[model samples]
Target: MKRSNCLIEVCEDFDCSSKRIKTSFIEGNNSSKMFRNTIWYRSLLDAEKSCLKEDKLKKIHYKFQDDKEMVEEYNVDTQVLLRRAWKVKGKLGGEGKWDVEIGDPMPDATPHIEGIGADFMESKDQPKLTRRNTRINLEWRIRNLPYPIETYSVSANNDERCIVIRTTNKKYFKRLQVPELDRLNLPIEQGNIQCSHSFNTLIIAYKKPQQLLDMDKEWYLELNRVKPIKDIPNDCKTQ
Candidate 1:
């Protein structure tokens, strides 16, 4: 499969075209000069196309049978209603009144806790312990492919609202924080974090600004691509 990046502009916009993007890339990257770049994503137009089609939501109305005033009775936000209408978060509410199912009702505000990522020497009940499940518990993901993350610490402030993932390279240490939406898997607008161990990098991708309607086609201008991304770097100082 051919790998590439592109933008989708409204046809009315005279300055935008997929070919124009390719010509620019060819001029910049000598490595890709001879290869044919394929695949272009246009998100806006695709959304428009999808919206015009007949309702794709298959109305399975068994659960909402009991509630007569389903739509008027339920209290949900616009985003929540959209999710329910499409059955993305699971069929919620009742059968005919289809609602999106929610998990254990969490506090309206987000909750986050920090755990350690290192080794333990003696029988001390250290709060941070390393195990297979560490991957799931750890909030910060390290991506260091071309280089290595020597050591670091994670700090959260303002009731866990601000999170900083710091890494050291012996000579200097840099701190990268997790964005609010990324902390909870919430889509802000359109973006992704693509990790490739083979390439030794974790690519933080942003949606092509001009891509009008193709949501699937993204121009990942590698934000943070790293290799050998380990939970714990080899050189962690014992506390």
Candidate 2:
């Protein structure tokens, strides 16, 4: 028995980025080749309609599984794509061939299995915010030095309020637990901290600040004397 397959390409641009196209396949049945062809062809038409309604296709390319070359290509503006697909359906079974009984209509195409439909729907419904890739940086401070702390590490809890800092001098490590101030006036973005370590200091930057609460004005004032530098000079190279 011969196997039949259809490759349909729908793209917004010639490069085919922004979304992916999925291929459909059906095996030929010796007893009901015509019926299967009608079903598969109708399904392709339905899919094309769905893609058009969502503006997913600017160009579509179709090819058969056995053919090494593409069978047809169409621009969405013209009706030739659908017409050609229909013609291909008729050709699958010989001309004037009627496999089903007289007065019996062709059955409606079977619905595509779950998750097997075109990926156009997933791309269309994706959230705009989730697609955005943005990074944020946060500056913090520590005050009232007990020792000349050199090497520092910082991490935050899931709440974004509780922060842990570790300062090291030689072989000694001192850990400090800090909680966010109750009344913060400064804007804070919540995200994971990215740490850059140098011989004498560690600069921590937050990646996603939108999730964080405002920084405390009182806390900022108290730690102003030992605040971490918000901006690093471009000339200053650190390991």
Candidate 3:
């Protein structure tokens, strides 16, 4: 999707750097169309159907499956560069029609199966957005860091913090363990994002509607969404 109010661009000249990360999403559904975590969940669903058909047992029993299983290869296209490179997304095919559609994720919509709804964070999945969030329709980020969106309202008078959100409210937000670190080149620390951004980019990603309105700060700033995510000169590490 075309990126505007890009976090990378706004923070670039500030000597901030950001790494491209491929984050996974798990969707579930009863239909043929896949949702995040469709693979394993689908398998379980099929197994459940099979067991029902073949069960000659008195009482049915099942094994407890971990919700955070990473047996599949799920990834989204990500294009990250110097914060000053707002055009970078366009140059690298990261640009496209994003916010124009009505189904795109917004304040209102059914949450993803993983529970990622009401969060303003955007993703790289096109068809998903066209289908899901728009009522509708849906990126990677640094390392394996789980980007918790923090929105704020700042203007001439009052500055307010509003929200703390991840794409969905699933295991991704709670449990971020992945064996595919080397495979996806995702960083190892889910909490070290602040320190990491000090070396690469600002490590901060902001959304559109730059206009500052009054918001809630306690919950919002708690996610570390502020002007100073990291100290200055973090981008020099890349140079």
Which candidate leads in TM-score?
Answer: 2
Given candidate 2, what's the lDDT at residue 170? 44
Model 2, span 1-239: residue lDDT tens: 12222223332353354332311122222322232234333343343120112132222222334431111222334322211111223466553222211112233354545665655343522211101111223333222333343455555553545455655654333332221121222223334555554433334445433212212122123222332333432211110
- Return the TM-score for candidate 3, rounded to 2 decimals: 0.13
Tens-place lDDT per residue, model 1, 106-170, is 12232343455233333232212111111112122223434442343334333434333334554
Identify the runs in model 1 with alpha carbons over 4 angstroms from their true place: 1-145, 170-199, 202-239
Q: How many clashing residue pairs appear in each of the predictions shown?
A: 30, 4, 29
TM-score of 1: 0.17
lDDT of 3 by residue, 1-239 (tens): 23655766777745533322211122221221222133433443343110111122111112224321111111112111111100112346553221211112223343555555535555633112111110000111233333333321111111211212233444232211221222222234323222113222113222211111111112122212222223223121211
After superposition on all C-alphas, the RMSD of every candidate to the true structure, in Å, is 21.4, 33.4, 27.6
The lDDT of each candidate is 0.25, 0.30, 0.23
Query: For residue 186, what is the lDDT in candidate 3?
Result: 27
**lDDT: the better of candidates 2 and 3:** 2
Worst 10 residues of 3 by lDDT: 131-140
Q: What ranges in model 3 sit over 4 Å off?
A: 1-173, 177-180, 184-192, 195-239
